[model samples]
Target: MNTLTTIERRAMQAISTDSGRMLIVAADQRNGMKAAIKDAPNGSDAISREELAEAKADLVRHLANHAPAILLDPEVALPAIVDDGVLSRGTALVVGLDASGFETVDGLKHTRFVPGVTPRTARELGGDAAKMLWYTRPDRQGLDSRVAGEIRDLVAECEAEGLLLIVELLTYQLEGESDEDYAAAFPQLVADGAALAVACGAKVLKLQYPGSAEGVSAVTAAAQGVPWAVLSAGVDHETFIEQIRVAMAGGAAGAMAGRSLWKDSLSISADTREQLLTERALPRLRELAAVVDAR
Candidate 1:
């Protein structure tokens, strides 16, 4: 088993249940949030930066108290959410380092970092840890090596600053890739991505569902000793709960769910947002937490 440094251990504890499972609420989306808001029935109004921040704040206010940690982006949910005291003192904060969107190169996706949200800056922002979303395609030649090198550097930076680094790996289909081919490869793509991240020194992971119970078990084995949590990837709440159950049974630490939890609140009134979150999202999260705890 890989032994954690003191700071890594503490940060991990802060974001996990007392039983050591990571039951986190992820609100660290920018483009995804905009899309959710724009797609809402009442979402005809022009979206503003303030609206994004407010949406995140609403999520935190209603749901942060229920989870062990909340993953937030540096752009919208940092100073104001913390400064305004909307975030609960009990929940640990994880600042995201990935910028909005990605660059498509040679039919593969490449990720970018937020210029100002480095490990040191995340720490200064009162973050217990930092997260980066990396686009992975192990089947592509030379891509894995390049991305692995970046993960290593970021891991070292976080270690120097005494902050935990949770690497979130996302696999995308190549341009013109067939749906059947992509579906067939999705399980291995996720499994390979998790193994690459863990080998590159990532201490924690937020991974997409690998598509089956067998694939889930492959991820757990590939993780070695590093703890990994399943990301929601915009799936529906019921689908995500089952994913969590399968993942925990396969040795996953827990979940870091986002759109699956609060996607409905994006287009609603503040009153409705609070009401739905309190009524719908909260129960969904509790069910997820129970699944994690059952592990």
Candidate 2:
């Protein structure tokens, strides 16, 4: 898999130790607000309308310093960022490729933001890789022949660019679905030539880490031998921290995080936030990495 260890090391060494360990800075800034997925847990509760609105604004406000991977719009956006060269190594500058969501059942392939970037853009971005944000489901609910075909093409394009495509789990989450069906369908999804694409080639596979003591086991079992990271699915700050810890405890390679990085506690200090993210936020991540290394 294209783990980008060298890039990670370089980024970490360069980062301020005052910031502590690397808490992925996901920077993919999407278009306008999106509707919450049907089955979004505490959808009506966790984040109130006011809070969610601020989350979007916070995304814009923190553009300069945000970490992890920034999922960018596929349209004529990202110009300022492009000029700034945010794509340099030590960062995962991702492009969001939203399929047929919020409307048509048939998946459509189009670049909505980050205009100039296509699968071909990565090579020029000075990028180690780009994630395809692949989110598909069953025959109709998720993937079908049409969606499958589009994914195949994307894979080809990403592969040609030597990029890594991470299948996003949020799509299904929004659609009110579970990975059980998707995981069960993954073998078939790959068998359908969707796996043969260029982008998915040996990169990190991402999955949801259900919030449970045994949750990681389920995720690991689903991932099998493939390299994978567990996501917290935009949980609250405390829960988010616990989620990352649990994921690391379960042997996840790393985390594909969002929300938590942006969601601040009611009265948290910047110093406390840094410690939580780098230290307590990812205690298990360090432990897991050491485990992988020892092996």
Candidate 3:
């Protein structure tokens, strides 16, 4: 039904459906993905890489370490976190673009971008899917046709290169912007890359956090005519679960998250949340998929 339902999609699904099981650690932090992984959840201990070895069931995490309490850091230190025996273990490590190239200077200080993890030199440091972030307000860098074309070409090239290029439609609407600016960018981003994403082997269309049902609804609507899976922006844990529920409720395809799961003091005492996904979220996703299928 959707495009590129290849061996990879099967692999993506074998990890399980995106109900509660599709929980990606929200590494896109305030400072960036690196800062986001500082503390995973509130009122709990951070979920460390060592603890992650203990996480059973389906989980999509950005590979990163954490402080004990009160912070989060999600910048992927190395691509091997996902490629080298990591995703093979069933954890979808959403690798980021090159960090060494993404940062810039601000006033007397420098601002570093904490994307999934920058594309590195290691050949084994490959990603399940490549993610690209376009800034709307602060940089407005996403608006350049040259940059846009480069991104578009990259997705296409990844597939041609036998890799998958999955782009994330992200934004933080600052500078007295209207909701229109937020809503306007997605279609164009998709229009610019849809064929390329599918042709290049991307499995899904990951969207930024839509602040309201209307914004998320727009995402779902835009995705309806396209052949890609859609998801809302990844926020906090409580909100992340709720957002997944609402997107499923709204008949969205699924979601891609970065900060909520890893940006906390995560001491998951029990698999209650994991059990909830199996018991509650998965069933609900099945229903949503059915609704979309019926259409």
- Reference-based lDDT, each prediction: 0.86, 0.44, 0.41
Ranking by TM-score: 1, 2, 3
Give the per-residue lDDT of model 1 (tens digit) for 125-167. Answer: 8999999988999787333577889998999999999999999
How many backbone clashes does every candidate have? 0, 25, 42
Q: What TM-score would candidate 1 get against the native?
A: 0.95
Error of 3 at 216 (Å): 3.0
**lDDT head-to-head 1 vs 3, winner:** 1
TM-score of each: 0.95, 0.55, 0.54
Put down candidate 2 lDDT per residue, 140-217, tens digits, no spaces.
Answer: 433334444555566567666655555444334224446687565444443222232223333445555554656566
- What order do candidates take by lDDT, descending? 1, 2, 3
